[model samples]
Target: MAAPLFLLAPPRSYTSLVNAMLGQHPQCFGLPELCLFNVDTLVDLWRGSAAEISENGPMARHGLLRAVAEIYCGEQSTATVNMALRWASVREHWTTGQVFQEIVDKIHPLVAVEKSPSYTISVKRMRAMLDTFPDARFLHLVRHPVAQAKSLLAINDGAFTIKVNAFEIGEDYALMEPQIAWHDINLNILDFLDKVPPAQQMRMRGEDIMAQPEQRLAEIARWAGLRDDAEAVDQMMHPERSPFACFGPINALFGNDPNFLAGPTFRPHTPKIPPLSKPVPWRDDGKGLHPEVVQLANEFGYV
Candidate 1:
């Protein structure tokens, strides 16, 4: 079995695009955000986790359902998705690792590439992936804390911060802190990666990938033991070409970010990297990133 390539990053770090792009490689099968490792069994996903904040409802199941439909049934349609539901029902009792192995086996030889940012919230979840796929390759995708925090705040008022328990509790109130989320999530990834061999893991900036997709993507392809030739490089350029790049059927409309689903096309351009000292745009208080956030950002090679 070909060990899967998992992108480890917090949300809004270009994981969806990168995963799809890599999946488009001739030797890869880019998967939607399966989020299977978030739980121990398939039934746990439906029944929900202990933490209400972690419970994802039906939308979370969409990715696995869509993937099952496409991989096993040869298409993702209403009928196929319903068939996926039946498929899951039969395997609800199986360990999530077992189910993931089945999918990896089904797409053998074509490396499975996936990213579910939620997996970074807990070390256990990431360790589950490593335990299941002992030889899994991990890509630690980093982003500027300022840019990532701003993006998180823009979405549902930084809802993910709450999910990660990233907050500052003042005497009067508790405020969401995106930078904390960014720092902690990356730290979690680092801790988990400590057990992985150096050769099995790589760290790359999301901004770098955006700035030089062709060169950087070819580098990544070569690193993953995939084809770095023109044909494969050209294929990797068009993330939209991936089956999971767009919205799935009505029953399973999203296996990736909704924003990405709406416009799955890849347009290469340099992303703006805001100065660390400047006041974050998402904050009303003229405050820059937290000291810890700045420290981590510097460690990541950001100015």
Candidate 2:
């Protein structure tokens, strides 16, 4: 079996679109965010999160549901989702790694490409993935901290920050800080990548992919040991062709970002990169980025 390719990044860093783009490769099967490693066993996904942060809600299972529905039954419908539920029930006692392997095996020959932003929330879950697939390749997807934090605040009223507990606790006012989440999550990815052999991993900037997809995609294809010829590159150019690129049935509605689902098409254009020292637009107090954020963003090649 070919080792699966996993994209690692914080949420809203163009992961959904990129995952689809990569999946469209003729030799690859782009998967929705399975989020299987968030728990130890298949059953834990249904039990929901007991931690301060609730990780295993209905939305968390949506990706797996859509995947099972489409893979097993060849379609996603309320009926298929029910079948998927029964499918999961029988393996409730199995470890998440085992369940993922089943899905990977089911889709053998083609590489499985997946990215769940939640996986970066904990090193243990990532370690579990490595333990399960020793040959798995990791692509540490990155975006400018400034751009990423702003995108986070734009969605769900910045609720993602709460998931990472990214906040500034002052003597008086406790403030939600999205940059903290950005810095720390990337930090977590870096620390985890330290354990992985350098050859099994690569880093790419999301903005670069957006700016020049054909070039970047071809570069990635070469790195993954896939076909980098014109035919393969052309296939990757249309991420919309991937089955999981669109919204699933009503029952298994989403396994990807809704924005991407609404418009899964890829448009190539250069992204704006803001100066790291300026005060973030989301803040009113005129405080600039934390020193650590600047350091990290610089490390990511964001000036």
Candidate 3:
């Protein structure tokens, strides 16, 4: 099987674009966020705990279904999507690792490129990924937490972090924390990296990728043991060219973020760096980044 390359990071850290970009390489297959490892069995992706029950409890399954439909059936239609559903049912008892291996094997000779921010939610989940693919390559993607948190709050009332329980309950039962998701998720990546060989992993700043696409992407390709020549670098430059870059068939319109799917263009421009000393948007009162967050931003080369 081609080596499975996983992008490890928290949500809103440019994983979607970067994953798609790397996937566009001729020898790589870019996949949407398949949160398969969150459960033991394929069917567990559809099942939900009583406390978290919702109509979309199995939200992660859509990506797998659409991917299978697109790969096997050549199009992600209602019929093909149903077939994909059946495919999952056949392996309902399979572990996520086994299923992931199956997909990688099916796409033989082409590297599997995937990023599931959900992987950072639990140390166990990250461990599962490492255990499953001991030879897997990892890219620890980082972004300025201030910018990430601002973007997160802008999207859905900061509900994404809330869903992950990346918040603190104060004595008054108030959400009193800031950058909890950013800090903890990054810590997860750092801790997990200790278990993997240094040669098999790379750390990248999202800003660097955005600001210097050709340069940084070529570096990434070289580090991942892929071609870094002109043609390969050219291919990696156009993330929008990836089939999964856009929304899948209407039946499964998205296997990734709707916002990213809507605009998957690659423009080389410097991202606006938010001030670390500024007040955070998620809070009513003015409170800026903690000392540790500043240290992290500096460590991430964000200044």
Candidate 4:
């Protein structure tokens, strides 16, 4: 069995593009967000989040639904997606590990490359994935906190973080908590990575990958014990070339980010790096990043 390669990062951190790029490699099978570890059982996905209705809560089940439909039935047709639900129904009694192993088996000999942003919300969820794929290679992908937070707010009225249980309400119903998602998610990744063998893990900045795709991707391939030749790097340059780059059937539009699905092209542009000490855009008051967020950003090579 080929060991899987898991990309560990919070949302809007270039995970989708990077996953697609790596999947385009000859020996790799980049997968959309499988989101298998989020729920204790497969049925819980349809149960929705315990939180009230939010912009992102309704779409939480999308990744897993798409993955199952694509993997089992080949295409994500409505009928196949329904079959995926039935397939999950049969395995509803099994552990997530067992279910994941079954999928990995079906795609045997090709390395499974996956990144699910929701996995960063809980240490337990990360642990669950690790326990299942003990030999899996992890790519700890990090982004600038300010850029990430601003992008998160821009997407869905900041409801994405809220849906993940990362926001807090003040007396005036104002959201004033600092770095709740960014700080905790990175902590979860760091803590979990400490348990893995150094040989099995590689940490890279999303900025670095964006700035120097060839060099950073080559390093990643080498670290993951895959070929780092010209062919591999060239393949990693075109994320759009991946089989799962486009939207699936009508019933399943995305197993990945919708924005990425519409346009998965890779243009070489240096993303603007926001100042670390400046005020964040999400807050009414001009307060800067929390001390913890700064430390984490520095560790990620942002500062």
Clashing pairs in 4: none
* Per-structure clash totals for the candidates: 0, 0, 0, 0
TM-score against native, each model = 0.97, 0.97, 0.93, 0.91
Clashes by residue pair, model 2:
none
Model 4, C-alpha of 295: deviation from truth (Å): 1.5
Clashing pairs in 1: none
Q: For model 3, give the 10-residue run with minimal summed lDDT.
A: 50-59
Put the candidates in TM-score order, highest first. 2, 1, 3, 4
Model 2, span 142-178: residue lDDT tens: 9988889989988888888987889999999999999
Deviation of model 3 at 97, angstroms: 0.6
Q: Write the per-residue lDDT of candidate 1 for residues 33-81, one digit (tens) a residue.
A: 9989989999988976424433456778889999999999999999999
lDDT of 4 by residue, 198-225 (tens): 9999998898889999999999998888
What are the lDDT scores of the predictions, listed in order? 0.90, 0.91, 0.84, 0.81
- Where model 1 places Cα greater than 4 Å from the true spot, the runs are 49-55
Supply candidate 3's per-residue lDDT for 132. Answer: 90
- Output the TM-score of candidate 2: 0.97
Clashes of 3: 0
Clashing pairs in 3: none
C-alpha root-mean-square deviation, each candidate: 1.6, 1.6, 2.2, 2.6
